[model samples]
Target: MSTPQMIRTPLTELTGVAHPIIQTGMGWVSGASLVSATAEAGALGFLASATMTIDELERAIVAVKERTDKPFGVNMRADAGDAEARARLLTKYGVPVAGFALAPKQALVEQLKSDGIVVIPSIGAVRHAEKLQAWGVDAVLIQGGEGGGHTGAVPTSMLIPSVVSAVDIPVIAAGGFYDGRGLAAALAYGAVGIGMGTRFLLTSDSRVPEEIKRRYLAADLNGTVVTTKADGMPHRLLRTDFVEGLERTTGIGRLVDSAKRGLEYRRVSGMSWIEYLRDGIAMKKATGRSLAQMAQAANTPMLLKAGLVDGDTSAGMLASGQVVGLIDDLPSCEELVDRVVREAAERIRAAGATLVG
Candidate 1:
């Protein structure tokens, strides 16, 4: 099929991509191969850097640059101790965008803007979106309750228009989005674009284990669950046996497991105990999470890596959107993006034809 005619939006104009679709930065999933392929396919892609060391992140950034000349972004942890250094890397390498999962400090926004880097933070609430807009962010990616990973309780249907109306900047709707029809719906709701995590994670270019990908494909609409048992924060995950067990376990049992995972995470991440404490403290202040919650949250990275990278479905948790139920095939990024754009355009045209003058 011919390439779909481009659909222009504030996001397309701002990011210089042919499509307004964005592939979210999912830890252990959105690596250079996936990001580069998505960029080449004319969608904005973000490399997940929160799981990478500074040097590893730089290497991944360089690798993406080597693979694709198109603009792409890096997703970062704003409160990370090395946040400034990561920002500097983006500036130094002339990366086009910087995406944050949490609201970054005002100074970081200013610093990126001064260096001509676009700042797009992922927010889950109207207040957060408004604050980021006031901080002069280029745009905001809003994930609703149905989104994977750490998520809020608000569904996209309500959250998208709410944030869009509350802020002047473009809003990219995430959570429960997977197809051209969904993209059309988001536009109808006043969003400039759509951001997809589970959709992108299932793509052919994603580095997730094939076994894990197959597991995602087999999921149905009810395959996912949002539970705080994972890290004391509401996280949407595939209802795997491991996650089910987690839900069944008492608080004490879960805490012990979290502690073990936290240590494993520290060892694998090369963080000293002091550095880990600093990060935990930072998390405590940022999210107002108690010490126990912070400890559980610290283990999340490792838990995800175990599933996505190591293919340990028994013990590792699979972060996923409810859209997992809707996904079946693993098309390459190019094919997937083109198909979505084409389908959306056709749907929009059909919808317009039915309108009365």
Candidate 2:
């Protein structure tokens, strides 16, 4: 198909991309191939750095640079012990944007901005949006309850307008968004763009295993469930036998499993015990999780790796948005971006035509 006409918005302008679509960073999913393809397709893509070690992240960034010259961002954990180091790496590479899953400290934000990087943080609430804006972030991406993994309780319809009204900075609406209609709706809600995670994770360019992608396609609207069993926080995931078992498992049993996974993750990540402890302490201080919850935190990476990377749904959990039910095909990044932008533009025009003279 021919390329669709560009849909310009503050998001496109701020990030220097041709379209207002953003392929969000998903652990074990968004990598060099996906990010570079999204960039070449004229939408901003964020590399998921939260799952990568510092060296791995640098290599991934270099890989994307080698593949495409289009501007893209790197998403990292703001609460990570090496957050400052990560920020400096972005600066060193001249990455145009820096995204944080958690709000970074004001100093960190300033440092990135000083280096001419646009800082965008993902926030779930209006208060968090306000706080990030106060720290001079370029934009905020708000994911509502319907989003996959570690989501809040509010739906996108309610959350987007609330945060848009609360903050002057650009807002990108996420959660439950899959098609162009969702993009049109978000723009109508006063957002500058839409951010998609599960949608992108299902794309052909995504590095997720093919079988796992099939499992996502098989799901219907009711295929997702929000549960606190995955970690200490509420996570939206596909309803599977393994996840159900997690819900049924006793707290002590869960803790023991978490410990085993944590040790495995430590070995795979090549982080020393001291480094792991430092990261754990930073997470505890940032999130105020109890020791048990801290242990559970380790379950996230390893479990996500099992399903998303290893395609072992029997032993791993899959994080997915409610929109999985709405998706059926695995289009490439170019086709997906073009279709969504085209549909959104058509919808907007159709809405305008309804206005009476």
Candidate 3:
């Protein structure tokens, strides 16, 4: 029995635009075309700026603006040296909401709030939600372990209830969400709504190659694997030969290759040698690693670009949530949103009828 509800969650309220739904920002996949389509479909879209250069980001933002007057958000890297500059661009472009993939400092949240922007950060743990609530975040987007990209061990089944009990803010449940059934499940767990990444990635509006989209659809549950060998974090990726090769390396030459790759990555990212080194230094300080060791770590932009823009899965890590396993077909952004809502409505009605003894 798939029980659903007719409850209109708080996320439906117009925060800065006219949609209750939010499209999770998918790195290279969330370009202008996808963002605009989502916005036009009566949902909020997010432009992924982490994968783009400043100039590319500006152009994409402008393109989205031209395509729709509805509000949209931009995902940014909190640890980047130019993060402040990117934040300022939000004010310049008058973006409706600012969504962070990682938890941001309270100061940045306060600043954005003061500027009248709604601040929502994606979190995987209840403790993180409590911290964000204390930091004055507007809402929390919770992802379960089933999600692709970077995810925590806790599933939405456990995390949503935990966060709801620990905090009083809106919770957006992510991870395995795809259809209305997922939305209904999220509501049952006390989340305000759902945010999707992989589901959207399989849509017609998605810019990834058809073959790649097909690869995701053919995947069944448990197809994704978590590997820390990519970049420095535990990244969920398709079990491909490239990932297998990296996992098998255990020699001096491997370390040297990693260092050389990081250097080349620095050049391609338009970051000066000093700034690149600085980021590495800061990362090492935070992670308790030696500065020199982190200097050999591949930067986020480079790794994401290698897979996102260049589509070379062999080169670096691509962040994906576990929902990729369930996708079966690519529909237009409008069609996808409509199908979700329509299915949700039907589910609501059926459940309501059952209660009408």
Candidate 4:
């Protein structure tokens, strides 16, 4: 298919991409290949650095740079032990954008902005968006409870407009978005763009193993459930037998499992026990989470790796949005982005034609 005309928005203008779409930095899924493919498709892609070591993150950034010269971004935990070092690395590499889940401190935002990097943080509520705007972030991506991973209780339709009205900065709508119709709806909600995680995670460009991808493809709209059983926070996951079994497990059983996963993560991550404690301390201070919650936090990445990297669904489950039910194919980034833009343009034109006398 031929390339469609660009759909310009504040997001495209701010990030210098041709489309007003963003591929979210999903842990264990969004990597160099996916980021590069999305960038080359004229949409902004964020490398998931929160799942990588500082050195691994640098190499991933280099891998993306080697694959494409298009502008892209990196997403990292703002409260990580190496947060400052990672911020400096973005400046060092001249990355065009830096995406964060937890809002970075104002000083870090200023530091990144000083180097001409656009700072966009993912927020789950109006208050967070307002706070990020006050902190001088370039934009905020809002994901509601229908989204994957840790999410809030509100749905996107209610959350996006609330955030759009509350914050002066551009809003990128996420959660339950998969196709051109969703993009058109998001624009009508006064958002400048849409950010997709599960949608992109199912793409051919995504590095998630095929077996896991097929499992995601097989899910229905009601196939996902949000449970604190995975971690001590609300994480939306596919309701496989393993996950349902997790829900049925006792609290003590859950804690024991969490401890085991934490040890496994420590081995794969090559983080010493002391270093892990330091990182947990930083998280505690940043999130004000309880000690138990923090221990559960360590279970997240390793569990995700079990499915996404190892393709062992019995051991873990897939993180996905409600939109996963609407998706069935694994199109390449180029095919996906192009079709979205074309379909959106057609829909927008059709809407206008209806109003024309």
Best-performing candidate as measured by TM-score: 2
Which parts of model 1 are misplaced by more than 4 Å?
Answer: 1-5, 352-357
lDDT tens readout by residue for model 1, 37-151: 9999999999999999888899999999999889999999987877888899999899999999799999999999999999999999999988888899999999999899999
RMSD of each: 1.4, 1.3, 3.8, 1.5
Off by over 4 Å in 4: 1-4, 352-357
- Cα RMSD of predicted structure 2: 1.3
Whole-structure CA lDDT of model 1:
0.91
Report lDDT per candidate.
Answer: 0.91, 0.92, 0.75, 0.89
Highest lDDT scorer: 2
Q: How close is candidate 3 to the true structure, as a TM-score?
A: 0.90
Measured against the true structure, the TM-scores of the candidates, in listed sequence, are: 0.97, 0.98, 0.90, 0.97
Off by over 4 Å in 2: 1-5, 352-357
lDDT of 3 by residue, 1-357 (tens): 111223466786635443346798887789999999888877778898866777788889899999888788998866666677778788888887888877776788988999988888888887888889989999988888877776778877888888888999999888888887777777778888888888888888888877666667777777778876655556677766666787786645556667777777777667787877676665554346554446445644566666666777777555667777767788887787777777777776677544354
Question: Per-residue alpha-carbon lDDT of model 4 for 1-357, expressed as tens digits?
Answer: 326555789998999888999999999999999999999998899999888888889999999999888899999897788788988989988899999989898999999998999999998988888888988999999998899988889999999889998988999999988889889989989999999999899999888999888999999999899998887889999889999999999988888899999888877777888978888898889888888888888898998998899899899868989888889999999999988988888888778544455
Model 1's C-alpha root-mean-square deviation from the true structure amounts to: 1.4
Report the Cα lDDT for residue 333, model 4. 93
